[model samples]
Target chain A: MLMIKTVLHFDSVSFRYPKQEKGPLIYDSMKFTVREGEFVSILGPSGAGKSTLFRLITGLEQPTGGKILLNGEYFSNRLGHVGYMPQQDLLMPWRTIWENAALPLQIKGSKQADMRISVEELLKEFGLGGHEDRYPAELSGGMRQRVSFLRTILTGSQVLLLDEPFSALDAITRLSMQEWLLKQWEKRKKTILFITHDVNEALFLSERIFVLTDPPVSRMEDIPVPLDRPRTLKALDIPEIMVLKDRLIDQLRTKATT
Target chain B: MKKWREHTYSFILLVVVLVLWEAIAFNIKMTFILPSPTDILMKLWELKKVLLLEHLPATLCIILIGLGISIILGVGLAISMNSSKIIEKAFYPLIIFSQMIPTIALAPIFILWFGYSIWSKVLVTVLITFFPITINTYDGLRAGSNDLKELLLTMGAKKKDVFLLVNVPSAMPHFFSGLKVAVTLSVIGAAIGEWLGAQAGLGYFSRRMMTQFDGAGVFAPIIVLSAMGIMLFLLVKWVENKTLMWRKSE
Candidate 1:
């Protein structure tokens, strides 16, 4: 078996917002690791500093103490190594779907003709083939999310961070999007760090789940999903998976109370 | 079909208004106090040669030149002001203060300084038109989402890329709205400047007609000036429609 290398490591990271210097620290010596090609979910309630963690990892904000390592190298507050999809679609209303998806490439200074050709194929694969020239206002919520996702992927980063990308969708659409994302993940094999409050989603998609306590997260528990590969909706009913789900819910409830 | 109906309704209303004016002029038995629409139209036809040869071109040139300068300077100032908080704080109050001083007050000063040439009129137009563009563009630039900015930053985008990609496009609607207001004011600005001092223009022509008590002649230039204002406004609207197709409703 090939050895799995650590793609990202959080070495006892600590952070406190500058405005609230005297307040409790947001991250108290937090530590974790994501292996190469792994799908991990950070499951926590709202205001658990989950977004703050992403901010630190994405280099939008620097950690006050400790360090973050990407591929065994010190990662500072610098962008471009990781792709991020914010909560909102954030598509430029003035741009067509094709133009919006090709933004990262444009930012990287790729030739327009080449960028269009490449983005066209990606749009087709993502079920946005005929909608390339359409404005964002014309697209449905799911289609817009797909375009945003395609834009994130086009950034060409090996590590992807998704911040509640489907929280805005209806239940039916969210399920379909989850299934589609799982398929995409299996095919791409990118290291994904997903942030969500949905336990079922975390269970269905990720190989491992990190349950974080409320803000000033003093502790974190990592639980592995020992399920078969190429999962389906049927996997949700598996006896062991149900047990794990109940366990996660209990942990979350307890954390909320305490 | 709906748009055509609306236009047809507008034409009927205009015809009714014109007939009413003609009735009133006939009852009064005087062309000076309220000239009939036909009298105005006939005067316009008689002065068409002078309008085309001299006044029309003069006014058009001043307005176009003033508008062009305003757009360039306005957008440039907006970009610089948005780029830094200190610069914005220093200049924002001064911009508002400039607006408070009526253009009428400044027109004579501009004439005194620049002389009775086209420069004074153009300068007055610039003074009136640049404010809307600058203020609207500034508001639009600042209205860009912080989330989007952070997303771009994470993509390793440079400061220039963020401004061009996010800021400029977001400012389009606001810029167009400002332009619509500015273009209408530009014609008025030119008229005011010409009222202060000028060798030739629709304003100069109108003043000459008014002093001579040639009511029909005065009405003729006023008609031409109104037409000029409408044409310039429509031109701006047409450009805005073409460039901002994204703003169209679904």
Candidate 2:
């Protein structure tokens, strides 16, 4: 089989926030590569700078050291190659679901006629076709997340960065969202970089997981998921997957104790 | 239905005030000082031909023209101020100073420059009305949460889009709040300006009656002026409700 090339490379990336003792260094000499079409989840505890990592990828924050390359080129805002789904949904309350989903396309100056068709397709695919006119407030948390997700996809970006997109939901809703998200990802096959503190979330969704430590820190481990493709809820009971879970749990527990 | 009930209370209060005024006026027997509401209404009816057709139109024109200019300038200046901290720093203090100076105090100066023409009244109204709009727009622009701003930036929202989509719309409620105050001020400003110097206006008519010791006539013009203000206020409120229908459901 032919090897897939790296789409994103974070080379010795280090970020130090200003105006703090020792500065807020979330990544120190951190290096990683996300292969084309890969779903990589950055998993860490709260304040571990997982969210900041998303900001870095989106160009909201620049790394103090090292470089970020997308598709072997220097990352630039002009690329418009990354779709970001923030934690809060970030839906404009003034706009209906259709309008909100259509916004990115509109901003990109896509034809208004095409926007309707494209948005409609995405909405229907995401199971939100009938609720087009409803405001963000009218939708449930899970539905909002789905709309936000579709919005990201509609940005026409090759890469999607999700920042705890499901953390706001209840457990039952979150599980359903996860299943839905995986299905969508399977269809789109876009490179995804997700940030979450939920170990099971990382385990359930990503093809690879990077466990990051606290401030002034580096990656604790970058482990390729050994689970098979087209995974289901039943796959969680696999002994090997359970062993992997236990190992990650132990890492988190030890880190907490220390 | 609930709002209609709320309106009824104010109506009842108005009726009580009118009844008390007529009773007290009749008991004391002084039509020259505090005319009965009935007497005032009769005078208003007799003068409606001239007052509503001529003086009322003049006052309405000045108020509308002044309000239109102020809203445009105020919202434009507010957007500019929000765009740059330097602009905000330079203009914000001056705007505060203008508010403190009081339009009434400066009405004479306006009369000196524009004479007894409609321009003078319009100028005064604009001065009185613009402040609240500027202050409210500024407040609205500043009200956006940091995360929301950052979210737009990350999503590739241009500076213009951020202002237009996020800032302007977010500031709308505050803008309307200021507009409400400005609408009332527009009438007050025009009336006060006309009171100081004018050939024709409700204020001019009221002053004419007051000097003649026609208390009923003066009260008639005063009531009409008040009704005009209320009418303008309700019109602005109607527009506000229509434009900001999204807010009402919330």
Candidate 3:
């Protein structure tokens, strides 16, 4: 088997909020690597700087020290280098499903005709084929998340950062959304960095889990799942998977106590 | 059906008030001091040619023209304030202070400057109408999601794109609400401007009728003005409903 290329690399990154110069650092000499075509979940409790990591990668915030490499190259400005799906769907109430999905293309100044084709194809693949004309208010929560995910994919970036995309959905919907997301990831073969607090969700979806135990986070524990491909929800009950789930919860509990 | 019920209730209340006024006026036999509803109606019919054809049109023109200008000015100011903190700080207090300066006081200055020309009336209408639009649009611009703005930024969006896609669309509901308020105030502005000085307008017509002790004549123009105000208000509401159908569903 051939070795996979490293699509993203963080070289001893350090960061603290600019305004809070004297405040505690959020990240200190943090280093990690995500290989190509990986579905890696960043699992941490709230306030563990899970979002700060994504923000740094997206270039919304800068790291005071360290190098961030995308595709084995460092760029000071990382905006547009990666796809990001925020916590809220953040759909424009005025825009219809197709229009919302076409936003990244519009920003890139794609022709209207070109936008029509790309958005149409993606809408169908995302199971939103006939709902393109509907406003955000008309769609259910799960459907809205799909539209948002379509928009994220249209950014045309190799790496995607999803910040708890289904935290607000009902349990039933969230489970389906996870399975659907995993299918999309496999089909597209893009590197995905999913942020979630749910240990079981991390186990169910990602090939590997990066547990952010605490911040100022110096390191993340990289652990591989022992599960096979094309996972069913029933696979969650496997003895090894259950042990990993318990271990993740234990890490989160330790953070909570501190 | 519920709306029809509301209209019937309003109609009955109006008829009851008018019948009571007619009974009192009939007993006193004084058309000047207290004109009956029928007397006012007859006077309105007699003056229809003048009010509808000339003075009514004049006032409506001032309102519509002033309203159009005010909308352009208001949206411009709101956008400027949103784009720059300095502009917002400088103009915000000035706008509030300007409102404190009553139209009764400002009307004289405009009349002195523009004389009896339509400009003076339009100026007054702009003064009255633009406030709501400016304040509401400013608030609406700020009300858009920061997350949305950031999302766009991460997608390589320019400031212009963020403004057009997120800020402008999000501000629509507030802008429409402000417009409804502005349109209603516009009628009042035109009347005040005309009251101070004008060649032809409903306010001028009413004043002239009052001096001649034609009570029903004064009442006639007042009714026309009130009806004009209602029509303009309803027109704004209809446009708002059409533009923001999404708002109605949520």
Model 2 per-residue lDDT tens digits across residues A1-258: 998978888889888875554756767888888898999998877777788787788888778889999888886552256788989898888778998998888778789789888888878878898988788888898999999988888887888999999988999999999988888888888999999878898999999998887677765478888888888888987999999999998887777777
Model 1 spans > 4 angstroms off: B7-13
Q: Comparing 1 and 2 by TM-score, which wins?
A: 1
**Clashes in model 2: which pairs?**
none
The window of 10 residues in a row where model 2 chain B has the poorest summed lDDT is B241-250
Ranking of candidates on lDDT, top first:
3, 1, 2
Candidate 1 residue-wise lDDT, B1-250, digit = tens: 8888879978999999999999999899778768899999999999999987899999999999999999998898899899999989999899989999988886888878899989999999999999998999899988888889899999999999999988988898899999999999999999888888888899889888888878788889888999999998999999999999988944
Best by DockQ: 3
- Candidate 1 scores an fnat of 0.73
Reference interface contacts recovered per candidate: 0.73, 0.27, 0.73
Candidate 2, residue B219: Cα displacement in angstroms equals 1.8
Please compute and give the TM-score of the first chain of candidate 2 against the native first chain.
0.94
Give the Å shift of residue B197 in candidate 2.
0.7
Q: Which docking class does model 3 fall in? A: medium
Chain B, TM-score, each prediction?
0.95, 0.95, 0.96
Clashing pairs in 1: none
